[model samples]
Target: MEIRWVEAFIAVAEELHFGRAATRLRLAQSPLSQTIRKLEKELGVRLFDRNTRSVALTPAGQAFLPHAHRVFEELELGRQSTRAAAGEVYGTVSIGFSGALNHLTLPPLTRAVRQRYPQVTLSLAVRVVTRDGIEQLEQGSLDIALVGLPIAPSSVRTRLIGREPLGAALPVDHPLSGESAVDLADLAEDGFITAPAESGSSLQESTLRACVKAGFQPRVVQEIADPYMILTLVSAGVGVALMPSNVAGIMPSASVFVPLRDEPTFMDHALAWRPDNPSPVLHAVLEVAEEVLPTPRT
Candidate 1:
């Protein structure tokens, strides 16, 4: 029988009063009684026994009540499942994090998403270099990326998430390591380990700019992409390097992080995503980013 017929049967069976069940269903008693009569006719069994003043379920109606309840229960469950699947923040969000830069913003952003949009799944891609992270975002492999600033190509939209002073990574036994803060000029004669110059690395660019502003050109001895490798080399006294202060968390035991003395020598980290990409989950993530990251000053 139809769902409406089953619904009427269950309501009337539960209430055992034609007038009360019709009021509960927001239907008139006449139509409700007719629907029950039609359902009984379709089943070829009397479902209720009623006189002018009272109504009661027949044996057949009692037998069908449980099954009718199951139908409505199952239908409601289906509707709830469909609504969740169609929700705006229900899908997976693939996030790409540049090496070491994640320390500045990834934790709070992911935490905000988890607390606010429980249905969204987070798939994180870590240790990706800034340039490569941007490429993955462009290719649709990543929905969001947290990377060092000065991103290339200008096609990706970005929101500034953090700004921190760059620090010098030095061997613990080195004389310069004892100082509270080291000057770029003092390290002018020292060998420097940095990321690949050809990788469009923002850290490398900031380092070069700061050294140039300090009236010296740094002597480059090694080019490594990973911050941990850079720290390992610094610990071995291979060379000194300039990195964001937050990289101190991953510094090797033999390496010590010291703040830089120069003013305006800061590294900027930002959240990048393609403007044309239209994932609803991505939009939800961006909202969380805005809430977690500091708003830029006018």
Candidate 2:
């Protein structure tokens, strides 16, 4: 019920040993045991299944662990917000960026936050994919992340900030590969390699929508998860990849990516965060990002 009770529970839950948890909390073992007993008594459940040999969390304890961490997160947020309201905006914020599209706003956003709040520290983590960023955000390891639209969890809030135009990835020897610009309909009959529709990836959706608008449903020959693999498949003459054209220099040769000539389809990029997060440091960085790259509300 008390703050010290929550602290004791978390320490014990993490260490799984009364003595170790007490040492971590800088409290005597007897008192720490008493704290756990009091918490268990109040909750009317055994949080741990322990014997002299080893210790482990009970089913109830395992379920309660995440909620306990959330309690701490909320308290920390309150403290940070209070400090920020007092004109002391100084806290660490973790940001996750997976793709190059986020780079357009990262530098300017970082500079603006540094100038406005000299005390804040920005922590950057390069995630391998948008799903990785979204997972980190849900786990509370990251304050914000660049994610594709329609992420799985509704708990995450998003603000659209950028849109990268899509293009066709075709084999070098393909007839239309020589064109300066290609239309989506031109590839209607061509074999297509796309991301699975279940992934909710903007790349696949944009490609499909553009193709449908261009008067054809693509002949999908393969569905690959990784965009790089999709490109590699295209390079091998498997199928044309209608994806973000901006990723030209990263992959190997043997394929040509050209701009879409018809109504341009774009892969959307957005900044995603938990709405429950009250960290003033994250709020400050988001403010700067909103200003640096503004987009129409979706």
Candidate 3:
């Protein structure tokens, strides 16, 4: 009737000898014999034909053996399923990341998660702006977010991942492209292609601030939501743009990236999540994030 009872019966049925079955079960021979007797009595069916010389399964014992094996198999599967649901092993984590991080922080974080937590599924929401990523995190649609910092929400938890300096994206043939670094003030007359302020992009805000500090408000010629598109416009000579230094790696082939001179400007990036979120999969993802993208001191 009980699982242990069925286990004992199966052991005896398989082993055939009471002493051998008990040895296999780590139980005493007498208790093993007594357990089988109780199982047969409870079922009102003779399970094993036994005598002083030998022991063998009755036809009924053979039939019950397969069922007993199935019960153990099912119980094991149930335990595994429960553990996975409880977040011990497998679950899905939804991560939202801004377009600026596509080439910078996103790749290593995803690679670490895949290598270390193979059982965990990573659902990525890419090309998300900092503001939208935070909104998604707040709405419970995203478990984690990689965003540029200065997040205004008090309910969100954040950690500073790193700071990257803003660089100028210019047409390859531009005269200043030959310079090692160009002053922000030197580009003051150039029209800028940038993310819209309403897009909630921290990089956009940083760029505007840097230009203002350099003694001029950059001439706004165009606004694009995606970083790559902004760079493409720069490459086509439509306008110049300021973007994270890492963007240089994935910029349009005709665009040249130049660091700003005499400017100590940097766009701080961070990881954000809701404080009240209790997803175990998120914790696993954070673990991998820490390993791949460690926080830098401000």
Candidate 4:
């Protein structure tokens, strides 16, 4: 009638001796006998041939053995499948990022994830900047994120992965491009391309601060969201922009990427996830990110 009763039936059927079956099941002989009796009563069939000297199975009991074993095996397999589905080694992850990450981080990040978690399907969304990415994360849209700025929300957990030094994008024919290294101040009179102030971009803020430190408030000529567009503007001599050194590697043609004289206004890159919604897969991905990011030099 119950699974325990089925187990008792199987035990006595296999051992043949009442005392031995009871011992194997860690039960008293009386209870094991009662359980077998109950199972036989429920099934309305005799399962054992009993004599004073020995016990043997009925044809029905022999027929039921394989079915009983199969039932238990199927149940265990179902439990194992559920656990595997919940494990870090399985499942899909969705990630969002500011456009800059496409050029500076995603290529390597994608390669690493593919190599390590080939079964984990990764989905990506291109965003304007850190603020946009964080908003998506908070809305339950992103499982993980690669953000370019500091995340202020206490509910959002993060890890600093790497830092890239700020560099300037300029036209090859521009006056200052001839210099081996250009001071941020040298472009004080130049028209500038920048992301909007309210965009919450750390790079925009850092670039502005660098200009102020170099002693001028930059004259804005264009406001663009995508880094590629910024490079296009520079290529057309529309204006100059400050970006991470990695951006230079993504350019299709030679513009000019000069190290800022200050040489290290770094844009910090971070891996972020929601603290409220913890995920084992996301945590594993974060670990991979931390492991792959370039290490800081002393």
Estimated TM-score per prediction?
Answer: 0.68, 0.76, 0.70, 0.68
lDDT of 2 by residue, 196-220 (tens): 8776456777778889889998888
User: What local lDDT score does residue 284 receive in model 3, on the 0 to 100 scale?
Assistant: 70
RMSD of 1: 17.2
Local accuracy by lDDT, each model: 0.84, 0.81, 0.85, 0.78
Name model 4 segments beyond 4 Å from true: 1-81, 85-88, 294-298
Residues 1-298 of candidate 1 have per-residue lDDT tens digits of: 7999999998888888999899999999999989998999999999999999889889998898988988875675465456557763566788987556577588888899999989778999877778888888887688888887787766789888778788899999989898998877899999999888887677888889888988998899999877778889999999999988888788888989998887858888888899887566677789878888875562
Candidate 4 colliding pairs: none
Better of 1 and 2 by lDDT: 1
Off by over 4 Å in 1: 1-88, 296-298
lDDT winner among the candidates? 3
lDDT, candidate 3, 1-298, per-residue tens: 7788999998888888888899999999988888888999999999999999999999999888888988875675566567757756566778887665557788898888888878878898877888998888887788888888798856789988889888899999888998999988999889999889899988789988899899998889999888888888998999999887888777788889998886578989889988777655677788878888898766
User: Can you give the lDDT of residue 204 in candidate 3?
Assistant: 87
Best by TM-score: 2
TM-score of 2: 0.76
Candidate 2 weakest ten by summed lDDT: 97-106
Q: After superposition, how far is residue 55 of candidate 3 from its true place, in Å?
A: 67
lDDT, residue 282, model 4 = 63
Clash pairs detected, candidate 1 = none
